[model samples]
Target: MSDLATCLNGDLLCTEDATRLEEEEDDDEDDRFVFLMSRSAASDSEEYIRFLFSRERSFGDFGHAGGGDSLMRARSAAVRWILQARIRLRFSLQCAYVSVTYLDRFLLRRTIDSNQPWIMDLLSLACLSLAAKMEEIKVPPLPQFPAKNNYHGKSVLRMELLVLNTLEWRMSQATPFVFLGFFAYKLAGELASKELLRRAVDFIFAAIEGTNLVDFRPSAVAAAAIFAASGSPPTEKSMNQGMPIIESPELDQILSCYEIMIQAGASPGVGVKRKRLHLSNGSDL
Candidate 1:
């Protein structure tokens, strides 16, 4: 097995080996930062925006197969489980966002048997595990994952393989979080605080619960969240007052997405019942 696979399976490491792993992780972070910067630059291009819009349309037709309501319920449950795992594992919000992207994309292509709700939980666990491995310096052993679904470590590993195959190994997904920093910088300039960024991220997470918002591009969604959290209307004067004037297609898209968020009950101060799946094992999905 690869060293990463061995570590994920709970193998013991010597002190020197651990130190070496830490150094490797630091290098990986540097590489990741470079890649993210490149992606952020590309995302501003018309070609990249078109690609994201096309991909959104492809995935938007999901949740209509094999009992629509059941599928949505399952998806909602998986999202909740992912959220809980993020908290318990102390994972970054970016990790959770990428995992949710994987889960949604997988469900878009693969149909789950709704009668077997455990399948959804297994998928959620696999996605979360993959996200942790991608975004975290040190991931917990597979066996250490939440055991509510009675899923064995082997099951999670198998499901992880399936998810990887289903996603065509496109693990580094472009989520709203990827564009968040850029948008926040554009909106708040040097005045952006950790609290403001956190609130915007929370708004994005809440909006993710809205099925209608799934069709929006991640960039547009990120832009809308920042706009809403800033408490500024998307007017010509307001948007261009002290900031770079967002014009034409980009501005229109963000405003449109914000409107959708409002209609879907993702507006600030709006409370919508997030869908949940209640299975026999007291495990979500």
Candidate 2:
């Protein structure tokens, strides 16, 4: 054998040091740290964290890998459903969007059988509570997630702690929907008749609802919402192409969603009857 081999076989080398190094490597491999870790382990964890936050998953695009359907179409349908259903009160669309975002983040770490729909409700409530806490200082202490058979506020309160823990306290406050609402009104313009403006808002709400389906780019949702609310009937050909493209397919889908909103009694109505606020200033009067 070579001279080095001969030295290693003879007791001329530090065998104890080699054995100790091997033992140390094995120990590191076997360690199960909760959070704290050695340098190598910490590096691995940091890589994982980076992966988690890397690409923001959009629910509108979730099912694209599974079929021929475009991501935009599914998202469009979902947005329509949310707006039509009126799932949350006040700016609930904003709540829904934030909740959906949280659900997307959670799903990256945990996979669920897509067949189980109740998980959607759980995630939705978790998002709502998180957003509410962030949005309102005097928010309801706990979420009021509705029960299957009862509307007891107590039942929703009981589940609050569990939901909070599951979310790990990451609740986003801003949503594209809220911003889109203002944009839609502005685009309809002061010159537009009241009926025209109201119709535009109705369509915009439908587009906002569309965001719920497939993973859609928020910008595209904004465009689709605007297109739908523009007081123009969307053609079926446009809807097929889907939002951001503004083709026939997309227009069709928007129109269909609008029809669904109307059938579901979600069409925007005349502003709530309100006594006109009388300012002390007599400039207008």
Candidate 3:
């Protein structure tokens, strides 16, 4: 609803409008997901944070050094699709974030051959569908997700299981958004205004969409986003508690991420959102 979202087509695209942006999805063949036992909803526990930061730090440079731009391009395209679904189907941005996490983890483990674009599209849809199921109650049937290729419900379910096994059922993970509030108040306290948080969300989303902040931990990105948004990092003096968010040893990492966040302000993955909304009413930024 702001100038940035309207101008950049951020996370504000309406459901009806988003549908108009793509072809109507085909009906999935009547196929039930096997071993699709109901799982616990996503929680921000220690394990979640561990899964996001601990497991992998070797995903590559997101470039052709792995081979070519094909993988990177596919990854970027999948993010766009997830964003569009988040806007259209009214899923929380957190769900989109989780979906992207699934996509990235899966891609890292099994690099999709450049020749198989359909695999990318299918996997993207499955990942988004699984995320919506995790983060929202009114998730549509698997066939409902718009995609370039018409995927069977069974196929999507298979991909979901593959993703699940590969991720070790890490349906929950910490994200940059989780620490935005903590850092804002830690740094600005009573003076923390909505503007500071808004700017930080914009910055975090932009960095996630590009290759700017992927290698850093979520806390680092959150601290860096606040630093980038409000003009400085949280100092030891600013901390009202035991440890500063960015310790002296970790200060270098935060600054590096902050520099990238500033450069990636206008990055393609920009998704400016005003509401700290939930998954149900949709549009979490």
Whichever of 1 and 3 has more TM-score, that candidate is: 3
Q: How does residue 159 of candidate 2 score in lDDT?
A: 35
Most TM-score-accurate candidate: 3
Write the number of the candidate with greater TM-score, choosing between 2 and 3: 3
Decoy 2 TM-score against native: 0.42
Which pairs of residues have clashing backbones in candidate 3? none
List model 1 lDDT by residue over 243-271, tens digit each.
34344456676787676555544343221
Tens-place lDDT per residue, model 3, 1-285, is: 432112222231223421233422211100000001001112233455445444332333122124357778877777877777676666666677778877876665565665656677777888898888888878886555666556566666777777788777867666666666656666666666555666776676676665522356566777787778887654545432512524465565677778778887734224543334233557232
Candidate 2 weakest ten by summed lDDT: 19-28
Could you give candidate 2's per-residue lDDT for residues 1-285 as a string of tens digits?
432122223222222222110101111111111012112221333233223223223222233223223433433333333222223233333444554555444444334343433333333444455555555444443322331122233333333444455446544423333233333433443332323323433443433433333344343344344444563444544433322223343344445455544443324431111122233574210
Q: Give the Cα-based TM-score of candidate 1 against the true structure.
A: 0.65
Global lDDT scores for all candidate models: 0.60, 0.36, 0.59
TM-score, structure 3 vs. true: 0.69
Q: What are the RMSDs of all candidates, in order?
A: 12.9, 22.5, 12.3
Ten-residue stretch with the least lDDT total in model 1: 17-26
